[model samples]
Target: MGRTRTFDVNEALEAALGVFWRKGYEGASYADLVVATGVERPALYSAFGNKETLFLRALERYASNYANYVPAAIERSTARDVAEGVLFGAVELSTRFSDRTGCLGVNGALAGSDEAEQARAALIAWRADGEAALRRRFERARSEGDLPANSDCATLAAYVLAVAHGIAVQAKAGFAVDTLMAVARQALEGWPRSGNTLVAEQRL
Candidate 1:
């Protein structure tokens, strides 16, 4: 085998992820990553390539490590449960870490500079994938009679994600878990069910 790698790559990546979570893509400097990872820029570069590549790797790690809620929410038997699962999960996640208050997906690139458009696009696509997953789940829910036949699954998905993203923003701004849970509940108030509203919309 080649010479043994000295630093723990997992720990380095985890540290880099924490820096990205707290500071964001454009906001996080090499110095921040260096301090966070306890690895010099040269070693970091040799291990992970450029900053963007490191951030992308961190994104993959975040998805694998933290975004388990997406699938858990999707697997719920009812559409309402799916929405509630994600919304409440977002609330929990956004407030779980005191140091890194919000979501990586929301915080990592939402505040990027114009020069960081590639990173911004990556986060945009990240959220879009979530919306697509929710939309597919909602379509299944509609077929299973958990949602109105005329319910706009795409809109529902977008609405839920919008609220979830909003929760992240608010959490970063120091909102409490109870406050975010209230927001989640308020969002669920508009969840479309399979009967009267459907008939009313049909009649309209």
Candidate 2:
């Protein structure tokens, strides 16, 4: 039988993910991955196929690991609460891993070249999935009478999604968590209410 692999694959992948998260797809070179993962070029290729494949894995890992707050927020709260939680959660996530800095999905790549196009598409799709989830949650809220009967669930979802992405952008730009949270609160101030305003009574 072939010799058993010595390195921990999950650990190596996490390290490789860090490199990709810090540097976008085009910027993260093979040499960079090697240094980050502590696995040589041959092993990296054998384990993960190629750079694009590795980046795609890293992107997926980032989504499952760090980008899960949107759904969690939607599940545990009111429609207004969902927006508040997502915006604040974005700030918390983007700033938590100081070295990584910004969200992997939102800041994973600059404008894509032909080679980086697939990676860019993967990130966009991940973001889009979150938006879709929020939309569904808002639609449910509207159906259940948590929101106004005439509330545009699609527009509200898009609005919250935009605010979350904006939080990521600001966090990547070095905005403080307090500053970002303040921004989140301000966004809630304009959140469309049912018969009465929820923003006035809510602490968020």
Candidate 3:
């Protein structure tokens, strides 16, 4: 019979996620993972396969936990609301935590090499999924007259996602939540006015 695992999987994964978020894929070594997770090397291998696999799993865990605000924000009243919630929510999410500030997805995008290509690919796919969802939401908003007929939903989606990415990058660079929110507010000011009413009328 196989030996039973000892540590709490979710708890350990959360720890691993923090390490990956702080260090990135290539920067996070096996020693780092083992120390952060409080698991022995052999046990870590048995539970998560390899460093790359562990990083992927940790990245998924981070996404499931912290990266969910985007989807929730997109479900708000208007396309402008979606953008506002997304940007402001990004500020809160990126800076709310002290140790793990910034976005794991954005942080992971830059680090890693050929060996970590799968992890990189996973981050890319995740971003693409977010952009796709945003596009669909904006397209629906345009159809509902929440946005002007000439508004490009794809560009709008890309623009918001890009801004969110910028927020993440800025957060990683030690910007405070208020500073990031200031940036968000400025971005919202540029939100397209539909029906001569600013979409960012609602306060953050």
Which candidate has the highest TM-score of all? 3
Tens digit of per-residue lDDT, candidate 3, span 1-204: 999999988888889999888878888889998899899999989988998888888877777788888888988988888999899888988888888888888887575668888888988998999999999999998888788889999999999989999999999899878889999999888777677345446544
lDDT of 2 by residue, 1-204 (tens): 876677888898899888887887888899999999999898888889899999998877777787788777988657888888888888899899888877778777758789888998888888778888888998887887678889988888888878878888888888988998898899998777765435435644
Give candidate 1 regions above 4 Å deviation.
1-3, 196-204
Could you tell me which residue pairs clash in candidate 1? none
RMSD of each: 4.2, 2.5, 2.6
**Which structure is stronger by lDDT: 1 or 2?**
1
**Candidate 2 wrongly placed segments (more than 4 Å):** 196-204
Task: Give stretches of model 3 more than 4 Å off.
Answer: 196-204
A best-first ranking of the candidates according to their TM-score comes to: 3, 1, 2
Candidate 2 backbone collisions, by pair: none
* Winner by lDDT: 1
- As for model 1, its CA RMSD to the true structure in angstroms is 4.2
Query: Number of clashes in model 1?
Result: 0
